[model samples]
Target: MQPLSHLESFVRSAESGSFSAAARQLGLTPAAVSKNVARLEAGLGLRLFQRSTRKLVLTEGGERLLQQISGALGTLSDAVAGAAEAGRQPAGTLKVSMGQAFGREYMVPLLSDFLARYPAILPDWHFDNRQVDLIGEGFDAAIGGGIQLTPGLVARELGRVHVVAVAAPGYFGGRAAPTHPSALAGFDSIVRRSSPTGRLRTWTLRGPAGEEAAVEGRPRMILSDPEAMCRAAAMGLGIALVPMPFALPALQAGALARVLPGWYADAGPLSLYYPSKKLLPAKTRVFVDFVVDQFHARGFAERMSGAGEPVA
Candidate 1:
């Protein structure tokens, strides 16, 4: 009989789109990952991945098998870790997915304390600018701003994410600042694909009469990374509606100035979400409890913000 380890490796390699990346994630050598995948394929007598020198493409069969195995694999992993470390500590890996911009600015640094406190639990992190399917790809948890929760999953809100509409000092020198949301059409703006919304984002606010101020204009630059958009806004490329935390340091340094402060829309909440389970296995329970405790005790809602009324 094929072991769960072989099946899990094959699924991760396929989902990650490469052996090397999956190997790095699973804390195994590339050769080890390759051998395990080969073992699984040989046992089934089926070719799961169509491999090239540059990449691995999943076969149709691989996709179906991934569906069958992913849920079971998660359960098995939770089960084994549960059985082995019952009273000692939560051991084994927790897969965490997140975006590039805020991950660098916040989550990465915050995780150091988490790791130190829970030495038995290891986090296998996937950082990307693109939104991933949590259920299909099998991430244990993801911390990000602007996540829209799907049904049957649980989204634990950390706090409100503040945003600022900003431009370079030179860009606004002689020009009138946008006092009304309708005035935004006159400026060159930068647009970013919001990972939380899974849409080409637009800036919106409530006008004086409680009307939705739809700020639409041609973007001088379009980017997926929030950090890039913040940098571009500071360099005078165009106006950028950026998360306050991403721009907070620069704003403090006087490198960027807030434009249309009254009309700026608050960012969606930062959250750590997971697939809700009946058992809430020991590892998930411990981590979730720890995270909730960490934030609630430290007043995360007040901290992830820059300034202004509470958006949540």
Candidate 2:
């Protein structure tokens, strides 16, 4: 019997008219989707999609196969979805991905609560800085900022991520804290290198009253990890722009202090991304709702977005 995954890929590609579109819906890469379709065609000894740079057109055999299997595929999907919804327990291995620092700070603590709430759901969470392919790598969901939306995927805004300037308490022992973004020029700055691009990131600060300024300073150190940037700042190496989540604990412990109060760089919304909205498994559905609820309940959205009274 032909593999069901290939059939699903074939039908989705035919309907969507491109592998990229099918990839978005199925959570696989275009290459992977094409490979699946090609494999299906090889097994059946037929050219399914007319290879082209512009658009994928189905062959006569492909059309016949699609017409014959489309109904069966729908029936299979509905049956599986019905079974998932009717299951008494949301018992399954829930694979998830998130940023290492963000996960450590926010998601790790919440796992206990989530597991407690859904005893049958097993959590397999991977923490990394790189963007993950949710469908290709088989992740049920991902939580982070700036996730690229592909076909069939949905994003829920958890909160805004803000970057703030931080320095060690000792670094400012005799010097006054920077009152404005321009004053940061006097300090030695530890900047982050973009992991994917290998380029240094610049810090642009937005004031409470809607003022904007980009910090220009002597680069004392360059690091790639946000946690390390915060640590370097705490150790008096240099003032660093860091995500608030990575700096929160040290700030609370007096290891690091905010340099410019009420000024932060908005890094856009932190989102929880997952696959298509149709007939989602109970485990994934509950987890998405639970995480969003936690963010709202704890005021993380306000704190992270630099909107609340203050972080004192």
Candidate 3:
């Protein structure tokens, strides 16, 4: 591999648009910047910049190289910062913005465990379902899972959240079992105001033809949150398509029954997102690490249900 020193200097020069400016910004002499770029071009066997008396322009080759170089340098920078921050065990307040149901169901238990482990750290938690502006709201991190991701934030995948279509035993007491997702149209359903999936978002099932199956249902009870959906299904009001974490407790208590376990949709991953910055303070890093380590991708559903799942 070519030396990163030369590649970093090359990227800095391209971004700054001049050797002198890049040198001044990086605390190196103009000649050093020129030499680094020359070394980089030699390593790649390509000319990067067209240098004139008054202006510097990147060659086509330089533009392509800059794309890869910038990302590499940025990753290296973050790695360095992470290493430096790890030495310190941070103490202070960490503000978390999360969905109301998720906050109550999972984060509360997770936070209790964290607080017990690190008594010095006190986190202020806020629960809301709408999109939140992390910088505007003064939030250090957000625990949100869905396909929609906020631009300019770094999102780390926690795990896939499984969704199950459920109803009370009495609701389907006399009716024949629904064989397909479309069959749910014949039954009442609880729907939230919004869905993670759009029109195409439906339960994916393997059909008789060995092809994938999808079905759409009309909402009998349009609810605002997962709790309402779960309750409606438990009360034998309708079939509710809800996340596994939300229905797990009731399923174990025998209050709710899984309608079609083999035909439920697999929702996407739950993620912890934060800002990608030069210095993620010690408290934020520790919280991120602690929560990620705690989740480890598998135990969240089991933990939420109060079931003992094998450790991931």
Among all candidates shown, the one with the greatest lDDT: 2
**What tens-digit string does per-residue lDDT give for candidate 3 at 128-238?**
886666643456789877524554478887766766778887887777978677788898888766554433334565433545656567778677567778988999899
Best by TM-score: 2
RMSD in angstroms, all models?
6.1, 5.3, 9.5
Tell me the lDDT of model 1 at 231: 86
Candidate 2, residues 184-265, lDDT tens digits: the string is 7888999899988999999788898998998997899999998989988888899998888888788878888777778898
Q: For each candidate, what is the lDDT? A: 0.74, 0.84, 0.73
Span of 10 residues, lowest total lDDT, candidate 1: 303-312
Kindly indicate the candidate among 1 and 2 with the higher lDDT. 2
TM-score each candidate. 0.64, 0.81, 0.64
Error of 3 at 308 (Å): 16
Q: In candidate 1, which residue pairs get closer than 3 Å at backbone N, Cα or C atoms, i.e. clash?
A: 146-196
Where does candidate 2 stray beyond 4 Å?
Answer: 1-6, 9-46, 49-79, 307-312
Q: Residues 72-107, candidate 1: write the lDDT tens digits.
A: 786877678567766776666888787776667556
